[model samples]
Target: MSELPAGLHDDQTNSEPIVTAHSFLVQQADLEREAAEVLPGKFDECTYDKGYIRQPLYACLTCTHPPSNYQRTKPDASAETAPAGMCYSCSIECHTGHEVIELFAKREFQCDCGTARLLPAGEGSCCELKSTRKMLAKFANTKNSYNHNFWGFYCRCDTFYNPDDEAVMIQCFICNDWYHDRCIGKAPDEGDYEDYICRECVAKHDVLRCIDTTLVFRGVVADGVDRQVEVVDAEENKAENTEERPSKKAKTSACRLLPDTVSQPMDLFMVDGWKNDICTCTGCIKKIETQKLEFLLDSDEIVEPEMDDTRGESLYESAMKKLQGMDRTRAVDAASAYHAMSIKLKEYLRPFASAGKVVTQQDISKFFDEQKQQTH
Candidate 1:
């Protein structure tokens, strides 16, 4: 069986939907079957004991009081301890109204009486901290940081985490934050994943394979001596790539410019002349490569596996010797997306292609554009 590339693996997402751009190609029944195969069982329901023991941050279920370790005692003569604790809202919502006993700060756990289904249904039974959904059994706050909004959890981007069932999300092994696959520009194919590390961690280590190859090495040949040299001057290296194209002078600017589509008066200016120009930067080159891969996948052309390209592999290995810690994780991501697109595109456009008419580029482009819009 083929294995996922090193440093790239699928997350254990439980019952959450795996959102892919190509999902529209599959039937609803087929998706449900796939989900069943991966999940095999229902999502584990959250409980008071589980949340209090595991989660570091939590708020009262009945009220808006901030998360605390105050535990309220049961009013019965037996003096049995309530499983959880509550905040100010829990008192007004049910505790005080029900003549519940005073709360004593228990350093170990919070008040869980709210989770026992003690309060009668109505205004008092509703929890201010959680959703009004009828199925919610326990209150939980696994968020690394606190936020007053409905989205309690936070992504690595430092933004509130919003769950979108239609967007594929991958969990980072280092930070444990979930990020949408598209946002990261790296997504896995349809398969079980066991681990993953975010780009931020990889970037911080300065190991990402994103170097200007043209500026690397330039040396004179010597007699009987194989000499390796490192070039230091940035301008000297930059000029080497530009010397051949003296007539095609690139516009030099101190600030980054944006296209007219995105307007920001304070920061960016619309550069109409440079709009059509192509960038040969390392990042842009990778973008072009990914786009070409996408194009090939959409066209139903054969996408040769990267492993089959010996020459390219040799070059990659040579570059890795020069640029240490380079991995095939990005290549694996690209390949996965390519294979998925190829399969889904072929299935979706088979009818149109077999209708005795030539399918044009516009037809394919428009079809995918519509599909992407629908997903959003």
Candidate 2:
């Protein structure tokens, strides 16, 4: 302390040491400035929209038995995927134990693996021959277009037609079936077309003769305005029956369920406890599920791929290049600072990776700016 050591020269005139403890502070500041310049949000970026997704074709995945009389049970509350799109036969055989999802007749997809006919012949064969009706077959074969006519246009003339058919067919709201204009005694454009019924159902149900008619619905979710059930209590029914017999000439509209929506012969029968509730029929319920899937697909909610390491000049590379002209120790210090900054950028981007969001170069630049602000 009294005298300087051999290699050290004490100069009262210049007191500052050659290498100070905070000497690298200037290098670190330069690094942050350069980082701001080099790595502005530099990651790959993409945005997703639902309009690009495709609607799938018709399909079923269920047991194939004859009389196909049974319907699938309601979906389980805990299950993520709702079981829809099964045939009456499939509901009884393969899916009896599991909660059954409602099924709709799809326009494009064929029967899934669960169909009896699709199963191995020895293990599970179709108990009854599948329907060979030309219209039904045509509808099942539809591979594209998801319009209302996806089920194929069947005319009472025993012929299947398309939208391009020369003869315009009118759809009977009663049966939700199409009939050739000529078959229903209608001209191509001329007939009181407001309301119509297929000749078959009209005759079978004696629709015109009955003053009061009731539609017994099954598998219908009573959600929208079109699907609410009109409940007539026993007392109300008796009171209404005794009150009035309307004039014979007055037209009595037939009572229909879920008008303007898909209806099937199966809907004619009612299931206990389903009255005044939503229609949970396979077809209707599947439609609901399909719409939801379509929305999710459209939203582009999936995670994106990770950013490549070799992408344009990385922050580390830039730092190395900037520090090359400096002293070895200073270069090493700058590189360490750059490494710390890179680690921070990675940490910030980690959450995006988990969320399936794309991290781009622009994101990196923003991180640098934030780091620069915090350091200052």
Candidate 3:
């Protein structure tokens, strides 16, 4: 095992054999499946070399802005110590066991781990990769943008986020801020939207409201109903036979296509494949450039969902698949055992979950050992 993070060390004043248990395979498998949903990406190297780009980040409170140890947070910690974000690799390899905040994916940032940007966590730099981590001369990234999220607040309501909350929070495709359905005047029961643009972004960017209506769309809201496209087709030029019709109807600019402003403050839901339909004509490109929204041109500006190949099969899933290929008698026995054990595990965990108590490592190990003894 690697050295413990700063402020953590086991004393050897009385030498006692430290025996590690290896009986939590079932629990580990379940965690792997859950973790894959949150983060399933390459973590081999630090993303300092990648420069400023949209990537997953973790805010190391211990390394830069140490949170209060009395279960209270320091007010205005953002100004106390500069907010530092680390890439996925650095989050695991460098700041393991630190009080890190997973900032999901943030836009335009480079890893600050072990760099001069982040104050040393303790005696040395805040990185495990000593040989390779850069000691940058730069103190802090001037171009990097900061928000309430750095201080652990989010959405228009500016409430502290809690994962256990029943209310669902969705990320806006435009600005990447998380929002609750009710906060945005959206009903929680409203069917899933392909992409959501917060009201602030919609009103700020004229380009969004004025996307050329002629462009083909897979899902479009017309007359408060969704129209699914069955074929590649554009809206018919309404003025084709009129004298006011221009000689070249196809040459119309995006701004002219929908030459009307939406004065209402409401969230905009985008259709499937809406990004692909963005008018890429020279005139449209020029308009987008002038607004300093070149990031919109990059398809990756919106974080892509993890692909199946990258999200390798979990241990439980692998076991289930293998059981299917086994003989009927063996498969039946394994399936029965699996289902019974899962129910028992859920019952064991219910009390902790209900009481809002954390299920410790020791609890999991003890539960599995007791099950083994009972079975024997």
**Candidate 1: what lDDT?**
0.36
Please give the lDDT score for candidate 3: 0.60
- Per-residue lDDT tens digits of candidate 2, residues 1-376? 2433222233445545432213334556667566545433322221111112222222223322212112233542332322223233333343444433332222223333223223312233222223322222233222222222322225654543444777666555334456665454412223211334454544443222122322222122222122433332433333443444433222334332244433322113211222222333444334435544222112323222233443345455665666787899988887788789768766786676565544444765897898889989
TM-score of candidate 3 against the unseen true structure: 0.56
Which candidate should be chosen as best, given lDDT against the real structure?
3
Note the Cα lDDT for every prediction shown. 0.36, 0.37, 0.60
TM-score of each: 0.21, 0.22, 0.56
lDDT of 3 by residue, 1-376 (tens): 3442222233445265322223345457667778777667655566666677888777776666533421244453443566677777777666767877878787877667767777445544444444444446445566666666765667887877788878778788778888886565533223323577776776677667655432222223233343332222322311221223232313345334366444454466654445543555557667667865666666466233334453457676777778889999999998899899989888887776565554556887999999999989
Worst 10 residues of 3 by lDDT: 234-243
lDDT of each residue in 61-158, candidate 1, tens digit only:
33332222222333323333222333333333444434232222212233243343232235535344334334344433232222222123334444
What does the lDDT read for residue 72 in candidate 1? 31
Q: Which candidate should be chosen as best, given TM-score against the real structure? A: 3
Higher-scoring candidate on lDDT, 1 or 3: 3
Candidate ranking under TM-score, highest first, comes to 3, 2, 1
